[model samples]
Target: MIYIYLYRLPPNSLPRMNKVILVTGANSGIGLALCERLLCQDRQIQLCLACRNMQRAEAARSALLVSHSDAQISILRLDVGSTQSVLKAAREVKQRYNRLDYLYLNAGIMPNPQVDFKALFKGLFSRNVIHMFATAEGLLTQQDRVNPDGLQEVFATNLFGHFLLVRELEPLLCQPGHTAQLIWTSSSNARRSAFSLDDIQHHKGVEPYSSSKYASDLLSLALNRHYNSQGVFSSVICPGLVMTNLTYGILPSFFWTLIMPVMWLIRVFTNTFTLTPYNGAEALSWLFLQKPESLDPLAKYHSLTSGFGNNYTQPRKMDMDEDMSEALYKQLLELESNVRKKIEEEEQDTRAHGQYLNQTE
Candidate 1:
């Protein structure tokens, strides 16, 4: 990964007056880092840090205020793994900001990973392999149970929930004059082999996290194709590997500590492993300053850092299939419609009961 600065902002000249940006997974890691950097660049930008834990969100806000006292930062509780939470979060955003300028979909998970280091080493030495797919690619993992939405937790959180949120907020997102941009925090770990049209949810013994991320990358491409003409542009980026809290939890603490030195050495060769949260967040921050039409909607951006720590964005080869993306899109549409109908029916039932009681009174 080479540090190629596609574009850069002059200074504190970010157009913050008319832009209200909302970022999911903003309590910590790359999400929080992006929020901080974006705010420093332009304190006038209103940033909504969407997180599941209100307490953590408050803590993050307090920390941001230490340096950026005038930054307009707020929190909206959201859990991308849950459909109910998604709808509730969207309603809150709509109530707060009538028009959204940028929506950074960065909430994701990789639970209970079981990576075969033997296979990894073998692949590393193989003729076809250039580097170890240690960060986000060529990894396999399983998460917890299916969500209340009756979808795999990974798929629901990483893709479906975000999809529902975008659909619900379409009115605000599709504002005229290139007003809105959807940036998906995708990964190089997203492999085409992990995804199957016959089993998009990974109900079988498949790795849900990798499959879901790949689905998301494809979905992002499909979204740009379907919605770009309507003023909504979608882009995906693979933030080269970073040592985040989420990654630290995947393996044993002792192992991570012991391997810290080796990790540093690896960083020298693999520029994709940005090594710090700040560098890992460069793609999201870069997208914030980019003009809508200048962005390549179909290409997945790679956030890379040079050996000397300069941040840049590189265009990565995305394995996108329109037919598969369309199939997944239709399936999600049906699922969203069904869930909305069920919620509406429940509301109607409560209303009917109230009316009957009123009549009896």
Candidate 2:
């Protein structure tokens, strides 16, 4: 269930003196690790955890407080897959903060993921073993379904929801003389062929996760083109191969248990096998401290862990074109209009149903 908060601040409460950083999916994995790293780096940040699960969000807040007792933190319920949820959360954000310094679009999912072990085993014998491990190219797929809003679940969660959030927060993010950043947790699996302009939702593809991530890269560029002059800069990052709940779903627990030794060995060749969430969050944490102008708008920052366990960030150019990115952006706007119309209609129907129930009672 979504968490709700009444707007109340104590007279003794202090205003935020440091950056206001908001992270979606902030309760676990890379998102949680990134939060911890941020607080460790600076105790003054006003951190907001935008999560669908309030219980987990509170648990994560308690954990962060344990590490830094005086760190500022708040919670908001946001399910990026739902239009009503996103709209509600956006409204609450405007009420909660005066400015949004950093927006981390870090929430995403890989549903019903399947790994092609036959190809995985075959790739182990090939010269591109390192490439296979780094990109998971042709090695993974996921089942996709329609959300309640009649949009592709993976697409809605990973890309479109954040797109709407940015649009809603424009007054805070795109104002003159005020700069804000949009940092996304894109993936190494994002491929050129995985995404299609005509099928932006990837409804016909098994790799909807990959398609959505690739779309994120394009959308970042589109955002830069449209909003940079307005002071909102957009960037994307790849957390490499982090072993999180998402990863656990890709293969069974026993399979991962059996491959622990092999994975560590493979880590020697490709540092993308960062494995641990903290190690995987290097680039995300790094970007938190950067000047937006210093980052490449078209590059996907990767978190890499060395064979000896040191973590670092690297930026690699993404395979994207401005023409395609702009086209995709326009399509997203059109889809946005359609969804908003549907949502308004749904709300009217919901109220009508409530009235009928009341009359019957």
Candidate 3:
């Protein structure tokens, strides 16, 4: 059930020159936490909760309004995995908002995540245990499928759909004298080795989520090269190992609850275990306060927690180069064109079949 809540503010109700921010997957987890933090930081900004589930979106909006009675919040149905949904939501955004300030590409999926207990047991004794737990390298796998748009599920949801939205909204983002920022919620599990230009969709790979995040890192750099001159900046962030629904998928909540003490102990050695969603949203909330122009194109911002539980944002140079980023950008453009053409052909065929049926009748 897709529902578009029309709570558009009257002319006088609009905040004086307030920024309009859109967050995808703003219903729960890190996305929802980021929204709460943003509203707390600036009461005047207009927020649009673009989510796949309308009920959850409405609930999230209501909860936010409880603390922020004067804030302007709207909801739109957006399933980033679907081509039709992305197009419709982009249209809605352009229609409803005069300008877009920050576009958070935070909606993603790790469908049917299965953790390898065998590898987990071996990693427990290895010197690379910290890295293993941090990256989940060979320990996690997800079941992915093909979407209606004829792309791999994880690729379409995490990367391709967001790519299309940016392209579609380029008019609002890439202006002559204004600036807009694209912030992606990447993960510590993002690995360079998991991604392959040859198998960009990871149709035969096990770590599609990691592959998607790495692609996002490359795409952010490529976007800087392509659109930085047009006044649009892109950055990536890692929320560390947050125990959100995504993490709950890795290990059951009860099991995680039992191991909470162990995780807290391990947090001393590797602050990547930013266990709470609020702590996970630290970098995302920090990025909102930054001057987009001053950010590094190749650096990935991280949300880190200390042994004392202090939160801070840190920027680390990604293991990507300009050449590879450019290559990825070109490839994405090609795929975008191809996918559009394919969908057009399908629509035409459906129309032709309908016409033939009507003629016979």
Candidate 4:
């Protein structure tokens, strides 16, 4: 069911110099589609796929190679939900690349998703049916749990882990004489009411997915405020209502198939139904071709598709205040400090126990 169009260039083509880009969760869905589109745009850039599953990463790389055989593509093992993995991946990236041009923080999760069918059915007949389908507002919820890092799984995977990676890679991202782009794959479901400064992790909420996405939007603005002067610019984009693995989890595959015609009908009313991954990546690819200085920090660029299959990117103002964004940034810094100290203590204890066992033997 998947098709990859082969693109070939002149045999004497040389790779571009110093254009290293890293994309997390690059093995599938929008991440993989973005990779394909990027290579199709410029096959010479150095691209690294940071994925949790190496086997899948390899498969993705092979698929990309079918079209871009001579392109510079590499794989990296990364599990952004885990603090230790984020730290390790950052170190590996530092050792491998001197400067990073673009970082696509596209990895995210919505574990144990549940849809309120009553709400969905009622909304379908309401005036806000298009809006509900576009954003899934008030219709979806998720069951989140704590990861080994002692953080909410959705928060850790969607926002905090990427924050830590950015902090660790500041050296590469904020290099002199060059501007780096931090592009977050945020969502339209991100609502101001879902996120709270005190409960940033959404520990007590069923809609942790929404809260985490909203947090990412706020964090992007904060990053630009703090790091823009240092040659690092941050932006967020929404891929619209794409049918990725995450979407499949919401309903059965057979159910989605049955509703395919209805979805297409809805697309005529709402451009947010970018059902395919390629269409979903329109905004992401559009951003790649844009100047970092020209983007608005307060706007979220969205991928929109017309009923006639036309694709475009649109930037809409987000409902957030600068003061709250700054406050959230400060709290994240404090959390990072506490996490680091805890990790150090755990390591020391582990080493001591190992030494004791060796001595006893």
Worst 10 residues of 4 by lDDT: 10-19
Order the numbered candidates by TM-score, best leading. Answer: 4, 3, 2, 1
Error of 1 at 265 (Å): 0.8
lDDT of 4 by residue, 191-248 (tens): 9889999899998888999999999999999999999999999999999999999989
How much is the lDDT of residue 254 in candidate 2?
Answer: 92
Q: What is the overall TM-score of model 2 with all chains considered together?
A: 0.92
Question: Model 2's lDDT to the true fold?
Answer: 0.92
Q: Show where candidate 1 strays beyond 4 Å.
A: 1-16, 117-130, 133-139, 349-361
Query: What C-alpha lDDT does candidate 1 achieve relative to the native structure?
Result: 0.83
Q: Give the alpha-carbon lDDT of every model.
A: 0.83, 0.92, 0.91, 0.94
**TM-score for each of the candidates:** 0.89, 0.92, 0.93, 0.94
Clash totals in order: 2, 0, 0, 0
Q: Find the candidate with the highest TM-score and give its number.
A: 4
- Better by lDDT, candidate 4 or 1: 4
Error of 1 at 324 (Å): 2.2
Give the per-residue lDDT of model 3 (tens digit) for 1-361.
Answer: 9999988899988868788899999999999999999999999999999999999999999999999999999999999999889988999889997789999999999999998989988987888887887889989999899988789999999999999999999878877778999999998888999999889999989899999999999999999988889889999999998888878888877877887787788899887889888899999999999999999988999999998999999999899888888888888999999988988998999999999999999
lDDT of 1 by residue, 66-100 (tens): 99998889999999888788888898888888799
